[model samples]
Target: MLKKSPVSRLENLWDDSEAVGMSEPEKLLYRSNLLGSDKRVTNYGGGNTSAKVVERDPLTGDEVEVLWVKGSGGDIGTIRMDGFATLYMDKLEALKGLYRGPEHEDEMVGYLPHCTFNLNTRAASIDTPLHAFVPRRHVDHVHPDAIIAIAASANSKELTQEIFGDEIGWLPWKRPGYELGLWLEKFCRKNPEAKGVVLESHGLFTWADEAKVCYETTLRIINRAIAWFEEKTADTAAFGGEKHPSLPPEERRRIAAALMPAIRGMISEDQHKVGHFDDQNAVLEFVGSHQMEALAALGTSCPDHFLRTKIRPLVVDFDPASPDIADTLDRLRGMVESYRVDYAAYYDRCRHDDSPAMRDPNAVVYLVPGVGMITFAKDKPTARISGEFYVNAINVMRGASAVSEYRGLPEQEAFDIEYWLLEEAKLQRMPAPKSLAGRVAIVTGGAGGIGSATAERYLREGACVVLADIDAEALSATRENLAGRFGPDVVRAVEVNVTSEEAVAAAYADMAVEFGGVDIVVSNAGIASSAPVEDTTLELWNRNMSILSTGYFLVAREAFRMLKAQGIGGSMVFVASKNGLAASPGASAYCTAKASEIHLARCLALEGAPEGIRVNVVNPDAVLRGSRIWQGDWLDQRASTYGTDKEGLEEMYRQRSLLKRSVLPEDIAEACYFFAADTSAKSTGNIINVDAGNVQAFTR
Candidate 1:
């Protein structure tokens, strides 16, 4: 059993007058720090925090005590008082004796009266009992990224013992809430003097009488772990020649502030903000030369941290002067997809519940080769702290692995932590509103099959849609077909040449006025021009570019201005072509224009990111149904080029794709809806191929 020391810092801190009668302002500050520290320690909302206070009883003559644990769905970092769920301490303590096993959880819940469960408030923290079990005045629990790095190692216990020398107690990972609290209760009973405890594959729990001491102790323990690991695995020249980038501090600061509000909104608390980077030459050099595949498999430092830092770092292949931002972003998107697949596999192996899982990568870490690691945060302060913690975790994990292979938690265990009831409740508490509901969307070239299908899909998804085409008769026919299915208010018709700026602008303005404000703009209005490069006239080239490229720009710009003013994040989809991926004979103008639209969407994505705007391109290869450009002479030309009849040429186009089936315009529309909806929150600057896997363009 761990023995208690005569001078326990926690005891002293709690007994101090400053801690006992802290000012409201000071308490708020302490609360903010405690929440921020916990958020940093885990991925997303992986941990919980609480403050105990005495309240006057209305009927009784004495004061009633309650523990205000962070409510479910509320992130500790930005959580406010309302974000907490107040529970009677006495009632919580009684719950312990009623449940003997995991199976009894439901029974125990049923025993509580409706009054005992506060539906008006956010769901109670899952760890409410855990915090209540601890007799400390204040408690802080986190899956500290540093500790997990060590725990995930094969000889984690040995390494931890060597590093901390028995100062920290290690607890095996257990399902949180009642079960873990029971285990912790037993551990604390035996080791009364232990200053803090580390849960394997979970996080750290530290407490003291004073908020500051509690907060600092958590940091100290992490630092001690880092220092010990650094001493053992210090690489002298591994990171040499790496220097920080020459970005202005002001620019970094502004970006940090702009991001803070959103992050703060998620966590519900504010703390001092600062930014730091592993911009030193040595660190950059080391990261650049490191084996990325091996390093990424190390897993996240802590699960809660996932909400802020994501599962894996974005690896940048050492190019500081790349003019093509789109290409670089493509590479990143590929890496993100790989990470998502890995995450899905991990979830499938571990998940036991029916709850919907989040697909968004909560946080992103930059592993810039030849540049040191940089962790982005909602604010500068959190970013700097996160960077330090991340660096330490990396060093420790690498050192531990050097001695023996590192092993992460079992899939089920990670799932349990990630989908713990407390955290799940948080997700349920504040149901995020659909920001784009009841808005209008307009697709250009709606007379075409793809355009009409896309417009119909948008109407089905609750958006009032206007289908525009250059042919008035065709536009009217499409409106008649869709209006009966989607209802009269859901579909409208317009006829205009998308190539003419004046005509396109006038249409957009009228649509905005008619529909209130456009939320989605699908720039699908385009014409195909095919001729040998030498024979392609300048007039043909200009005509294609004018409609396909410049037209897209004009429509998207108008939508952006409208969305910004409406204070809503809007989505835009540009219909480019598979030819945008590569050059092809007799389609030089068409290919160039399509490529230009792709680039334009990429730029829009970046500019709109801050304002919650999303822009993506759909590259459809050979969508032939109802295409005006695929008729008559155009069809004959394409047929001749393929050495086949019109029917055979169409079959060849469809069969060339990996799936060997003709992709319907509706399929492309489905892909568009994904980008247009809340499902793709983190997806921006992405180009999805609706070509049935024909063109496997390399995304960064």
Candidate 2:
């Protein structure tokens, strides 16, 4: 059971007496962080908190009560004082006099900005009135999963009485708005002794004279509710089966790989890009359960979840034993189209005159009987977040079913929350997304310096990146580092030997399963070898040819197939060297291999043009600083050939270029991004030389 008192980390922020020197907002900051830090309490930006304080107005020099509530787009985990929007209490509460019901949803949004005590303060969260209407000096609200489980049950009122013994008030489902706030205020007047109110199919609220008391009350109520759940669900046989069943992992992977591409092709609207794919073990177990239909049909366990996961997930009928990929894809396409049609009809039936226009009707989650759950969204992060929320919803639904029949709000109520004007206003306030926000990119040789730099650049442009390399240690390290910045959902590491066709094919198949399909392929995996023609052995030449020439062919062959399956125009970039064009002495093996790779790109470009796939090359020279090719004997030979130290030799190469600047991996990355991104949509079968203005290496 959760502790009845707040987990006070305030001591970490201050010594015994140091807290006395803190300001009211500063105290709330520490308290807010504690509340937001728990995922069970909040997910991403799901909850809000506030404290009542008296401060003098700058103009009037008179005391005023200001409500410091968490602002929109603020995550409590790392929120600062600026995250709290200060509202004049009198000004905000007076709006209750203008109770216009749910129809004034748009008008309520318009009036919020004008209520801010300072014009520069961030917009308060939509639940601001819920905090303002309460009589307590401090309020804390969170969508605890355990609390939601009970509140969404068919016997919610009974459960509330059992858990709180009439100490808490229960309100029926109402679309959140001015009227909901008005109703809460009346409940407080009628039940003055109640510690909190459980909002049906919404969340929980607790209040007290002190911040700590309110917070502790919230946790205590949640903990008691969780205790009731555990006692009721103690019989494992009643819940049935494994929480996660062992359905051959290989078969699950195969099914996801085959189904995602078809789903992407159907949902994608962008000409050159498609959505990302993600799956979870919890979701897989839920779909495999005998009670899958019953639990899912209950709709969203919480109204806020409708914004992420749709009102109900479209369960795609898939058989793991199906033998034909093409046949299976055709069947899934028909099902998905029907899902869209049904969604349109639902919207038409439920919408009011003030309702927002319906959004694209693509199903977010695909529950395959044998294949687990597949989530699709414009980008990997959103897909991953959606998958996570679904997993939690499944848990809540199951928990509720164990206690009583799970009951979510009606479909019309869910529709109201999904298309609420307040959410639209918040979305419109965001900046434009990056160019390749929904695209998936794969970089071969990705643990290497140039490849890693290229992967980083694609992620910066908002593309989901898969780093494929033969070096396991480097691949793992690079993946962990990049995941720290862009999140694990958008960054993945795969071990691939480009020389082996099996390895290359498996890499693309996994990419299809992990991210639907590929929109960009960077072929940079190769080994460098240098020898005079007379001394060049067949073994050395063949080694270079296998890695550089054959590897490029294998990557392109698989990439083109997946892109064609997706029916989306895509980009393939081969990383060649300037030495292919400008012959260097004792570099026959390297130059010959590069030449073959470069020409292969042009040939593939010619064949792919009819399908709108563009193939290009980036030729870079003397990127020696971080390159593995310039180590040991190779470095010695290059320095000996130039008649100078390694440092001086670098300067000589820099001067050889017309621009007189040393080329770096980032310079090559920029050229690759241009070819892969929509910026160079009209260019194809072209070579971009990143040798700092190499005159001889320039494309003809």
Candidate 3:
């Protein structure tokens, strides 16, 4: 049996302040958050909510009924007052006479803006009419996986009665629009006893006069469906095809590693349109199932999933227990080609003159037996979202399969949703993406001042960054900080002791496995040795030289090798020092090592030009902030040597520069960005000084 009421967890969170101060719209928003908080109820930005209330018009001060519906860009989980687009009820209801059916989709869409209650300019969801016509104070619509499983199944009406006992209403699949709303309103009026309505292969809608009642009603119905599913699937186990010997963990990782790079390469349209890959256990289990090919061909459980995952997933045949890598690779290539061909044919068959040119035909989901289902997208987050939805859809399919047989909306229905202008409008509302949208970058010493700053810049430009550093503590802190700004998965951290050749190679290899291949490499790992040539010990000189010179060599070598293998020319920026070009007193070891690094970049530039690779250097000086070299003993000694306080020394350096400005880590980071980005496409073997106009270090 279903839980008669919601768990009441959110009610505990609704403290006295919120409960006392809450208005009708806020109450509706609170319920939206409750529904969105549960993934089973709504995936990322997939549902809508609304409430009808009487409010005074801002200009007229006359009380009027209004429908405050969730706006286009508003996520239910994080909606606020501004996220609701309030429409005058009388104005919206008048549109009912204007809408006939699917033929009026464009007209209805065009007329919605004219009905705005306030001067609000936000675009409301297409389902606004569906909420407006319900005639209930509060209405909640969600794409719960459990409900979708039942609704998409062949025996949906039979199961609906068995589960809800006619307490819920059923609306056969109608494309959501003015027509859906009209149908739903008439059905609710005729069957006043119905607590909720299930839209076949669409989603569920539950409503009542009170906010809590509407929310609880939704929970009860969804839980009822879930209870039935659990009862029905209690004895069923995952299908894993014919049993083969399982590979060891290391072997599995190796297979995944090899498969990801090839998958990324195969799906990439070009260097500029490179995509990312991701997978999970559930995805692997589904892909490895004996009936995967048959079930997946039935199409997605719902139309909403078609936006992220195509109508049906592409299947690739492979046996992990087999030792023939060559054969597996050949099979993968052929399957990919076949998928692309089939996708083009599907597009040709369904495309109308008004339809947009076909999107890239690459299969978002690649089902590899014994390995897993790999999802591809232009970025990591999108790829991850695709993989998640695919897993959820598979679960729904399995549930349906267990009960009877899995069935879903036809391919044309999916195409209708996929190509609908209303659906595409949501995507068009987003700002243009950054230039490095699908690229990956790596920054050595990424926990330090310049490295961390550069990583942040790259992320802002829409590139995934790998922060490689030897300091575990600092690395964790930097990763956490950056992850908070962009996303948890955007900035990946790898522990790398630059002086260790093995560590350097492993770091690059790991990045290749994580994000396919590297596009930009910022070689910026080094230490300072400030001693008079006579006083400099062999240990001190060797220590500085090892990190400054040898570390650069190891990192650059591996990056070059990987870039060459991938056959994609890339960029590399070395963080050399101004002292390398302009000798400084008592800095022989540091200057010599930096000078060596600069010359190495020049040599690599010459070697890589033919292959379209570019190597450059940024020379920065007197950047003390966020510099570990300026802390502890170094700070005290430098201050003593300058015969002043730390601030005094900083001022001295600031005044010494021709520009009379203190050099900063961010200044160096900008130069690195120039080299790593397309801005320096025509230039290489060049050194850009970031020392606030250092005349002595000038190079032309």
Q: Please, what is the TM-score per model? A: 0.49, 0.92, 0.92
Sliding window of 10 residues with minimal summed lDDT for model 3: 1-10
Off by over 4 Å in 2: 1-23, 98-102, 118-120, 236-246, 271-281, 321-326
> RMSD (Cα, Å) of candidate 1?
18.5
lDDT of 2 by residue, 428-530 (tens): 7788879888889999989887898999999999998999999999899999999998887788889999999999989988888888888899999867766
lDDT of each: 0.63, 0.80, 0.80
The true-versus-predicted C-alpha distance at residue 680 of model 3, in Å, is 2.1
Looking at model 2, residue 143 earns an lDDT score of: 83
Better of 1 and 2 by lDDT: 2
**Candidate number with the higher TM-score (1 or 3):** 3
- What overall lDDT, based on C-alpha atoms, would model 1 receive against the true structure? 0.63
Residue 76 error, candidate 3, Å: 1.2
Which segments of candidate 3 are over 4 A away from where they belong? 1-21, 240-252, 270-279, 323-333, 509-516, 633-647
Question: Model 1 over residues 233-312: C-alpha lDDT tens digits?
Answer: 56543322233343343443332222222222222112111123455433444465444435555555445443345445
Model 2 scores a TM of 0.92
lDDT of 2 at 145: 80
For residues 1-700, what per-residue lDDT tens digits would candidate 3 score against the true structure? 1112345222222334564668888888888887777767777667799999999999999999999999975778777778899899999988877766677666697898999987998787788989999979999999888888888878887877888887997888988788888888998999898888888887899999988778888888887888888787777875534343345555655565566656665666463433344445556667667777888888786776777888888876777667566677667778889988998888888877777667778888776666666677778777776776777688778777777667877777777778887767766767887877877899999999989998988898888999999999999999999999998767799999999988987787677656767778999887886777898899989988899999999999988876765556789999999988998877789899999999999999999999788999999898899876777766676677667888798898888899999877888888888887877899999988898887889895
